[model samples]
Target: MPAIGTLVDSFDDNAVDAVLWVDSYGTYSETGGRARVACTDGYSAYASAAAYTLAGSSIYVRVYPPAAGGAATAAYGQVSLLSAVAGTELGVQVNAVSGVLRCQSNVGYWDAAAVEVAYDPVAHAYVRVSEAAGSLVWATSPDGSVWTTRRTLATPGWVTSSTTVQVRLEAHRDSGTADYAEFDNVNTLPASPSGYAARKAGLFLGFF
Candidate 1:
């Protein structure tokens, strides 16, 4: 189990905190209280947090649509829970080009389990992945208050067997133009009586 208090970054410091994350690729920085990733054409970028146990915990991030300098043919923002072992991961992403939100799990490939719907920036701004008691859940929220479950599945062997997992933020673009994505309120909360609801309540109350 992790500590009682949640780990969070509002990105107000104008710098990616090295203590909280490892910049994995591309250009990442903090500006105006949000983590920003600049992705060049036909490229991707991401950052990962320090490893931590996921059992009985929830990880989430607020993702904004990609902002492009020109006609955007393809772009998206994603949040993921990743195991150290290859091919073990779960993620949720909002596609700027397709205008859809998707949740997927990977065993060896990304098709293990998946779900998607038309994306609504207001209603699906926040994406979350949680683990509890042997099950994994994917959900989305507008204001990080009310949540709608997207998918749920039995905990994968790789995840159940791992000691810790990392949370990742990713941005990708396939267009001819460069673009960027913004993320905020990257949070990992421990188990609570009310679970996600409790966390949201605390967020509104400034208790997180």
Candidate 2:
């Protein structure tokens, strides 16, 4: 059986994994639609959390400039996984660049996951959320690269065992200026592989 212990809480309400997050804290550049005040030269800085007791606790972040100027817009950045306070276990942290919740995870599949959100499309420069203002979209990813649509979830599927997974959203833009996004709820969802579409959407059934 899997090890038994506390899984660890990713973050708090205003915390992506912890609370809400955004992109580009400065004014919009004439060329780049957005401009973030990076701690270093485009380096994901460490956010101090004095109260957090998790080992190696750090926040690794990435960005997606508005899809306008820089060719780097298409460059897919690697994910940054982190540890939560649920327990001693370290959850996998993925680099989120397109939606509202950037990245979040739990101890493999033994426990629930905590997610971060970020969606700042130039056309819609706000966090993408459900009508109820939830930050997660219950969907499936094809090999952890692409996600299925919102309506195509299968039933009696998406079991909540070890394989259960969370579908995180990253924000994408068409320009690089004023690109800031916001998120609402960090979700803990199950990934349906069989009944769910590989990267599409439809009716779904399962017990996650």
The Cα local distance difference test for each model comes to 0.73, 0.26
List TM-scores for all candidates, in order: 0.80, 0.22
Q: TM-score: which candidate is best?
A: 1
> Mind giving the per-residue lDDT tens digits that candidate 2 earns over 105-204?
2345333434433433332222111111222233323232344332211111112122211222223333333232222112222345654374334343
| CA displacement after TM-score superposition, residue 137 of candidate 2 (Å) | 14
Estimate candidate 1's alpha-carbon lDDT, on a 0 to 1 scale.
0.73
How far in Å is the alpha carbon of 97 misplaced in model 2?
A: 10
Best by lDDT: 1
> By how many angstroms RMSD does model 1 differ from the true structure?
7.2
Model 1 lDDT-worst window of ten? 1-10
Local lDDT at 8 for model 2 = 25
The runs of at least 3 residues in candidate 2 whose Cα sits more than 4 Å from the true structure, single-residue gaps closed, are: 1-68, 73-80, 83-178, 188-208
